[model samples]
Target: MSLRAYLHAIARCPSLEQLWETHTQRMAEYGFDRLIYGFTRYRTSTSLGDPEDFVILTNHSREYTDEFLHGGLYFHAPMVHWALAHDGACSWAVLHDMTRERAMTPEEERVVEFNRRMGVHAGYTVSFKSISNRSKGAIALTAKPGMSQGQVDAVWAEHGSDIQLMNEIAHLKILTLPYSTPSRALTPRQREALEWVGDGKTMQDIAVLMGLTSATVEKHLRLARDALAVETTAQAVLKASFANQMFVMDV
Candidate 1:
């Protein structure tokens, strides 16, 4: 499909699974065979929030993620630092430049070594515009094995604008979809209750609207609070909204 058509398809992704499949295929056409798109909204002064809360979609091999993501090596990745500091595309060549200049620390050397072992040598990282001061999202595009950094740079030189536009569209579309840690995802009933509450409905009002008793409505709200790890209905509304679980369109 054409780039324009693919952007439309990306915007229409109803779930993360479908979005991952479509995005991986699209990136593959650009000479990148692996992609990792991640977003987080719960960042604080000292923490990047819980790992489960991040919307992560990747096509990297299991062995790689097992060590990189599951093992928390991502926290120490040098490119992650690069992405967090800048707001545009960056060539992985910078990693090598730092290495050659003897600038990478021992911890960083380990990350590079791990990437080499996993065949994650050449790629680009794009840090998207922050949706909020505390929220940031980025994507890592890993070129197919045997494609050197110079070759990947050539592809970017030819199709850079299209790649940036596609990723921006994808970042925006993901915000419209409901996503949460499995522990925080609300039940349909709980979500319905929260949506009404988010719309300024009280427990009695939600009960009247949802065809349930006030006590039942309160029960759902309490469950939602627990699921979201919040203390009150107001907090639940805010947390669920942050997770894109409330006020989501059916599209």
Candidate 2:
């Protein structure tokens, strides 16, 4: 598929299966044999127990994935760790060359060996975060050794923004998915108050705009905070924005 077509497909996928199918098709077009797309909630309460908060999809062999997870190899994978530390585009070979001077620990070497055995000679990984930046994750694309850095760079240059947007969409999907521990939903008035706050209106200003007493505005704001399970209004606004429930007004 053409780059534009690949991006359009990614943008159009509303479900995890569709997202993976689009990703797999694009990977084949780009000549990659193995592609693993995953979304992890690094700091969520359930993250420690359930490593895969939401996996968008993957075309890699299920055996390999199961082994990788059971072995807990990802936690010690140097490439995964490095991806989380950096921003922008990154390739495995580039990172290897850059860090070659420093010796890998025994555990890191084992992780590298595991990946090598999986036929992942070279790859690219991009990291992203949710509304709360503290909860972050990374997506990786692994390929055989002969692939050139130039090819990877070109793909990234063309589709980097779309990748970022997909990551955001994935994050929002996870947030809205039903959890075992049910969470409160925002009331219409609370949502309205938070939307105004997200638009950068102060309590007094929002009261005037909504034609409500300041006391009533404050009550709505408090309700919004409770509904979002945030400690304060600022956190509530940020959460709403991350969930695509509100947008900041230019004014």
- Estimate every model's Cα lDDT from 0 to 1: 0.87, 0.63
Each candidate structure's TM-score, on Cα atoms with residue i matched to residue i, is 0.92, 0.57
Candidate 2: clashing pairs of residues: none
Supply the global lDDT for candidate 1.
0.87
Candidate 1 residue-wise lDDT, 209-240, digit = tens: 99999999999989999998879889898878
How displaced is residue 125 in candidate 2, in Å? Answer: 1.0
Model 2 agreement with the true structure over 192-242: per-residue lDDT tens digits: 888888777888998998999999999988887776677999987766654
Model 1 spans > 4 angstroms off: 249-251
Q: At residue 60, what lDDT does model 2 achieve?
A: 72
Clashing pairs in 1: none
